[model samples]
Target: MTQPNTLPQVQPSTTAIHAGYTPSGDYRPLTVPLYSSAAYEFGSHAEAVEKFALRASGFTYSRTGNPTVSVFEQRAAALEGGANAVATATGQAAVALSLLALTQGPKHIIASSQLYGGTVDLLTDSFNDFGIRITFVDPDQPAAWEAAIEEDTRAFFLESVTNPLSTLPDLPALAEVAHRHNIPVVVDNTLATPANFKPLAYGADIVVHSATKALAGHGQVLGGVVVDSGTFDFSDEARWPQIARARERYAGTSLLARYAGGAYSMLVRSKFLHDLGPTLPAANAHSIITGIETLPVRTAAAQSTLLLLANFLEAHPLVKAVHHPSRTTHRHHERAAKFFPRGTGSVLAVELHDADLVPAFIDNLKIIALAANIGDTRTMIAHPATMTHCRLTPSQLAEAGLNAGVLRISVGLEDPADLIRDLDRALAAAEVSGDKSTVKDVVFA
Candidate 1:
């Protein structure tokens, strides 16, 4: 038999720098060339017609795809072990497009109660307005997920490692339930980058990311990606009408029959993304590409710093709880060990004993910036109740396990000792201003 042709597999770092692009012709550029043109010129009207009809593969419009964004998509897909990917303007758009493509009004989705406040808002408000119902379930309870599934349930959504808390979901258990009912599992792998935790390997059918966080590894650019594993069968017209139903525009050929394995992703691009239009600018895409090159190194360094901070905070007097699985006392400690042996991606939530000290604690931080971002080279902090999750109602905050006193810290590549010192000084200042009765000498493990 003739040898099956396969590209030699490279490691994650190698794939990040080289997978999606190749230098060609004289004066070959070292990086992906930014094709800034709004539209690609076609040789003839026939060729343009063919491209527009989805029968041909070529960049006809920037709104649909771009060279720089295509490179980001390809590189992201390779990293996640996915077949195809689409990059969006923000991670929120990626999340919206992923679910919108799967189902529409009158269908149902079972989502984890432990989710970013923004996501909860989208599902609870916007999606509700669109007539799609969502059921929030406790991710740790496998039975709850199974029980919540309805006849019109189209998808199961959850984060690989939860925002702020770093709590892990039972992906295998959740996927089993969703797959048993022919529903897809969509995971937001933002907090835990693919370098540390690839949701696809844990039975996720589709993976989404907020590239502004860990994938970019820098706080400069804003982007998101939706990756399709291409393993799930969407051939059942009865379930996934968007992909499996034949359309008059495609000459009665269904998207699944035409694109085969890539049906779901093609529909995402051609349908929702094309119309809604959250295109990642080519320049921004180029910057995100640069960020991805050092993903492996950046992830490891930041994760190490995070673990150190988490340990120190867990032992502090003013801290009531540290919500990261790296700690032995954490509820999901064993789950972290099983799913994330490398490390949980570097974001943790600390609940202070005195919620009144939050403003002072935030004010005293010298090195850490009080910002709403994660997975960057510079460490930052976020207040869930007052910042990211401020829009959520009291009931919603309780569902996500966030409270007024919880502060989310994202560790960067800074020296662990310096970060620890900053934290100590901040806590000390807050303690002196708010409560002195329980203040004690600082200690770290």
Candidate 2:
């Protein structure tokens, strides 16, 4: 077996293209190849015993690991500057596995208030029913995070760039707060994918990705990944009582001692993935792997185009406000400049003067597609108040800045001029009927 190499300090654009493929022998494939088998043949009973007992490493099932997924995991791990990664079925599954691996009943987690609605619903509602108590804080305030942590707090969660609103939190400060309490910090790096920001490099303990977004670079496949920085000392018995308790439950030693840097990832694989069964199929893994190859190029183009479009939209007469991290009006501008100075990423939101015009605006657009999914090669847009954030209550929607007049734009790899032209025509058509007060009330409810 080959020892894993220590991650080098490398540029993200370079890492995106070349981190994972360590080819051996005469395959000489240009792209990462997929391994389609469901199971692996054991060489002997001893080999099988070692694999089962974790005495040695090998793929036992494609649901857990396969060549295509391994390459994807390796590449993602390298991009996030983590020790290892486990690819899963969706971003929600990735979030579930990361938290569930370290916790069971009666655990506590501190999470950001400005999070994806699905995540808010998961933690505040469903996970709470399962005995996980969550404390929500404004990620904008680092002190709120420190104050929210309890003795039982196992993890602190935040998004690198918050969905829809485009808020960027102070990662280093948040990590410091979590580390002071000897807890791990897991940052959802979906919006700012490693091409723009690597949370682990800024002291985040673990990074989760919704690979369905920019990493996949297309809306065709759905997948997620959890990368372990392997920096936290999980076996420090005084700090991690759960790990100590876990050692007692199983015949194995403390996870830190048994698996070293890979303890969390291993637990996630053997326990969460195995029991929950949110495993990505081999075919989906193959498609996501192919999509990842051009991740850097597509994201770069998208970021640039979004900024240009934001500037145009901000000046347009029909638009009430523009919400992009790079915009001076954004509340999170300072944090965005520090963390994602290259760009605020491709997603932004526009609040219109009248909500009635939203449908007309969307339907009038020629170049951009009106769809719920984002980060595709083709530009897509959505009315989050009516679609993605529909589950949220009026007060909750207002808290997330997802009121009736708001519309989200997921810019794609398209000519900025053509996009602006299409949006110009659409905005004109949307406002042609004039401002209507009836559109101001809650459309989502």
Candidate 3:
């Protein structure tokens, strides 16, 4: 292991390329070689025992570790300015494992109401079976989070930039509140990739990503990662007994004592991942690594295109409202600008004059594809009210600022003119089908 004092600080772009792997002197492989074997061979019986004991650095089973996945994990950690990272089968698993690792017993979690629908389901439905309680609060109000936190509150969760609406939370202020209560802040940076935002840099304790999205940059892979900033002190036994207490399964070793700077990552990998077995495949890790190499360039182009499209749609007669932080009219515009000066992100939501026209508008688009996923090379659109946020109740939808007319667009690396023309034609088609009798009460502001 490289000593912390000897570690070199490099730019994210540089870290993406070279932080994880180095060619062996004999083989001189330029890329991270994929190890497909299910189990690695041990030189001796004693060596196998040592590997199982976690006394040696080597892979024993693919479910636990692999060379390619490790490279991806290391690179992701470096890019996010984290001490370590654990790759998982999907983004949802990353969120689940991170939270589960923190709370093994009955505990409380304060989460932003504006989370991804899938995440909302996990917290409310699935995790409730395990005696974990979640309290959802508005991301815009820091005081709400303060009031909602309880004695058992272990973590505060929110997205850096919300999924469809692009809402920005005061991360630094929230992190301060969480720290004051001895709780860690976990930020999901899937929408605002590390290329655009590093949550840890803004006082976030941990960062999570759906590598299937922007991190992979292509819609071809399914993966997720949990990164530990290594700044949160898990030595507080009362707050985080999972890390501070001795574990019988792992030879009675306390994770915090065993891995001081990387207690969170170590616990997640050794405990949750070991039992749950949500492993990222070696091939998928390779694809994500390749996708990450071009993330900066891809995200920049997509972000610029998103801004142009948002502006175009905001001025259009058929559009009722545009929800993007880049637009000055957005409620969180200033906060978004303060955190993400490079760009708010590639995703934006726009409301049409008629809720009934959403299907037609989506059906008429020629270039943009209709899909549930985001952060792809091709522009993608989805109706959040029916798709991503469908799980939420009617009241939840209203609180989230989503309506039946809202369309979520994930901008891609395409010509701005081509995308604009596609949307213009689609809007014209949608307008033709609109009921003139129902248009009187529709507000365009």
Candidate 4:
């Protein structure tokens, strides 16, 4: 088998389809075959020991590793220009495990104020229970991140393109601030997949994704991945003892010593996933691998449709505001243009004239499905105030630039004309219903 790293570097579109798999000899399958076995047999006891000691590269158990999942990992790592990758059962697990592995105890993390509600919950609720402290800072202000950093700060986290609002931060600037403090910048690239932006290329230390979204473009599987840029110096034993210091757990070998460039990803796989057991299934890995083959084309089409819809909505009298970086009215337009030249992505948020019109507007849409998930072949719309961002307090919502009058739309692989027509009808219906005092706030079942 040819290593993904050894394969000649190529364009992203070509790499998406042919990075990890290389069939040779008698069994030359055109596609990557699924290996569903829970365990693999070793040729001899010596070989088993060697594999267990990380001296050889082979899978022993599905919980820790699988051949099918490895292919997906390698492909993703190559696409992100990372040293390696680790796949998790869900995007939430990926976020949790990545942060958890970075710190052993009572550490601090500085995160962007405009992040996914689920991530906010994970940091403020779950990680708080574990004694980790998190401080939210406005991504627009690079100095805020610097001011919030302390000696115990382990990582700096932010979304590449913030959820719902489509806010694009100055990633390179924020990363520089974090790097100066010897902190790794962990970016959630779920919204802006590698097709549109590569966070690592812009100075980010780590990149993670909810592969459930754009990577698995059809929305059939749930998965996430963490990729390490292989540049962060983990040899600082005082700050990152897990990677730098020798431990008795794995034969007293430090990860940084064993895998010089891939310490972060290697530790995530061998320690975090090994103990936590949030393993990605072989079948799901195969499905995500297939979805990635068409990511560039799928994302491009949907992004184009999204820009058209955003423009149309902006022109409508009913829409109070449209929150997309592609719009000139957006504060982050220049930064977005510099980073995401392709498009801001398929997701955009629009604020209506009144909050009461949301339910009626969403219910009236015949073509767009009402769902929380994004990056699908079909269009999806959701009320962020009640759906994805409900966990946030009023002040937090305002800080994140989300409100009750705002609605998020994830454009899909549909014709712009048909989508525009459907949205036009829905908006008309909503306007009519908004005029009536008897209108209710209940969403359609």
lDDT of each: 0.87, 0.81, 0.87, 0.89
Per-residue lDDT of candidate 3, residues 142-180 (tens digit): 999999988889999999999889999999999999999
Question: Tens digits of per-residue lDDT for model 2 on 1-445?
Answer: 1122343677767666666765454766656666778898999999988887767888877777777778778889988888899999998899988987766756899988777777888887889888999988888788989988887889999999888888888889999888988889999999888888889989899999888888888788899999999878786766565454456533556666677788789888877887778987777777887787788788889988998899999998778999987888888787787778777667899988777787788888998988887778889998887777767777677667677878889999888999999999988877785535444564553
Worst 10 residues of 3 by lDDT: 436-445
Among these predicted structures, which one has the highest TM-score?
4
lDDT for 423 in candidate 2 is 96
RMSD of each candidate relative to the true structure: 4.7, 2.4, 3.1, 2.5
Say which prediction, candidate 1 or candidate 2, comes out ahead on lDDT.
1
TM-scores of the candidates are 0.95, 0.93, 0.95, 0.96
What TM-score does candidate 4 reach? 0.96
Residue 36 miss distance in model 2 (angstroms): 0.4
Candidate closest to the true structure, highest lDDT: 4
User: Given candidate 1, what's the lDDT at residue 387?
Assistant: 78
Pick the winner on lDDT between candidates 2 and 4. 4
Clash pairs, candidate 2, are: none
Ranking by TM-score: 4, 3, 1, 2
